[model samples]
Target: MIKMRNVTKYYPNHSEPALAEINVDVEKGEFIFLVGPSGSGKTTFIRLLLREILPTTGEIYVAGIDVLHLRPWKVPYLRRNIGCVFQDFKLLPNKTAEENVAFALEVLGRSQHVIREQVPEILKLVGLESQGHKFPSELSGGEQQRISIARALVNHPPILLADEPTGNLDPATSLELMALFDRINKMGTTVLVATHNREMVDSMRKRVIALENGRIVRDQVRGVYGYED
Candidate 1:
């Protein structure tokens, strides 16, 4: 669940807000797509949810926590409730797939027993059960992305935010990745993806939130990608 009310974000010394008068509500267990052109505030939207940057004006709530007012020291606690995936597949080059996923829990000070139990199960959930021993360089782009997804989900965060998750892959690979996302959503994680892939958006037909000039232009259920390429 994410809610934003009259949210606007302005960068320092900038004449315009990166996001303006944005209001959105994402219920638990929903899969949604955020589609917009470059500079349209998709990244800004994600950053706001993650509390990576504070909004200049308005309110934000994720999973019932008031994000805007959350203390800096409490940010980590907020992050623990949300999983994030990025386009770069930010895997450690030297670590195996299992290690990368396990490291997330390890950083949170999870016990070795818990790490061992959760890592393999998450890898299997992401269709990487056998590839856990492989290094990032040894895996295909899709496989590496799957590893990233496994890492994100190992904690079973209630919300998953992915920004341009398929930007680096081929069409088939993108489809595969989307299917994986769908599977994750089915398991009760709220999914929000910010992407530019028109065909992917159209085919998936999920909730579509279109942004332009830092404002929400359209919010539709089962919507196609409506902008021209």
Candidate 2:
């Protein structure tokens, strides 16, 4: 689960905050969508959860760890519990799909045997079993993104955070990716996606949280991407 109360973040020399007076609580195994236009604090929200930046005033607890007071050396431990996917695929060009996923586990010092077992299974889970031998450049946009998702999920993180994950794909591919995300959520991983994809959000009809001017304007259990901007 995740909790944030009265959270506010401000950068130096900025007249306004990047995030302000935010309050959110996400339960385990839930699928949530954060819908907003650019500069609406969506990225800031994700960064805060990752402890990439501290809120100027507030409390944040993710997966039961007090992120604010968490020690520098323990940041990695907190990140281990959360999987993240970004707009860009961010794959290693030199590594094949299988190797790309294996690298994540390798960072945790997982044994070669474990990596071998996990890499193939994750590729299969992402519907890229045969493509494992291919490099990122050899794969299509969707496949590359799926590999990124596979890398993020290979460790079985309890929480998944995706920021504009479908920004680059075509509609068909985006829907396919969203379907994969839905399946992952059903498998018990809490999924929080920040995107402005109105069509996708309306179709999913999951919990929707809207942000604008760094403040949450709406929280609907079953909501759509209703903002026109």
Candidate 3:
């Protein structure tokens, strides 16, 4: 569902590229972890896939749309194929979890009836059905993240990209979230998480792509975190 070839991204006046010669493929329904220390280009990798910034050189395809050459006006359509979760919950303070989730569909011009139906289902999927009425501030850190996950999935995007998803949670909460991600993947959505949570990565033992200094150093099947965090 994701393919990259010789991708290189250089920023203005930076002596080094953010990502260098990246080539990788992620199959549909697969769960993959992007393991790296800070400034190791994991975020850069996701940004490239999202086409938030153009790669200096190389090719990228997400769900078969050529990201590098996609029309600017069509970027939204491309993004509809991918869900994004971040370290920060990024929820609107005033919006309840259900409204936040419904907002995603609303932006897509979905009918109120559709939003009403889909929003509850997505909340339930993330184990947040009982907390839908709560705002981000009213929820626990893990609960807020679950709401974020629900919002991201309300569109049923084929691919889910998470950057430092477990960064702000406790270990037990992080484990719970990871289990939710595993469940999501089993239901046939491709899941790619960029993280520094070695315990979570090691315990899950999924396909791991390790990055350092803007390059892929290891891509292993059923891999552990392998190195110290």
Q: What C-alpha lDDT, on a 0 to 100 scale, does residue 111 get in candidate 3?
A: 99
Ranking by lDDT: 2, 1, 3
- CA-lDDT, candidates in order: 0.95, 0.96, 0.94
Which regions of candidate 1 deviate over 4 angstroms?
Answer: none
The Cα error of candidate 2 at residue 159, in Å, is 0.4
Across 1-229, the per-residue lDDT of candidate 1 in tens digits comes to 8999999999999999999999999999999999999999999999999999999999999998999889999999999999999999999999999999999999999999999899989988988899999999999999999999999999999999999999999999999999999999999999999999998999998999999999999999999889997
Q: How does residue 4 of candidate 2 score in lDDT?
A: 99
Residues 77-190, model 2: lDDT tens digits: 999999999999899999999899999999999999999899999899999999999999999999999999999999999999999999999999999999999999999999
Off by over 4 Å in 3: none
Those runs of model 2 whose alpha carbons end farther than 4 Å from true positions after fitting are none
Give the C-alpha miss distance for residue 30 in model 3, angstroms.
0.8
Task: Name the candidate, 1 or 3, with the larger lDDT value.
Answer: 1
At residue 212, candidate 3 shows an lDDT of: 95
Q: Tell me model 1's lDDT, rounded to 2 decimals.
A: 0.95
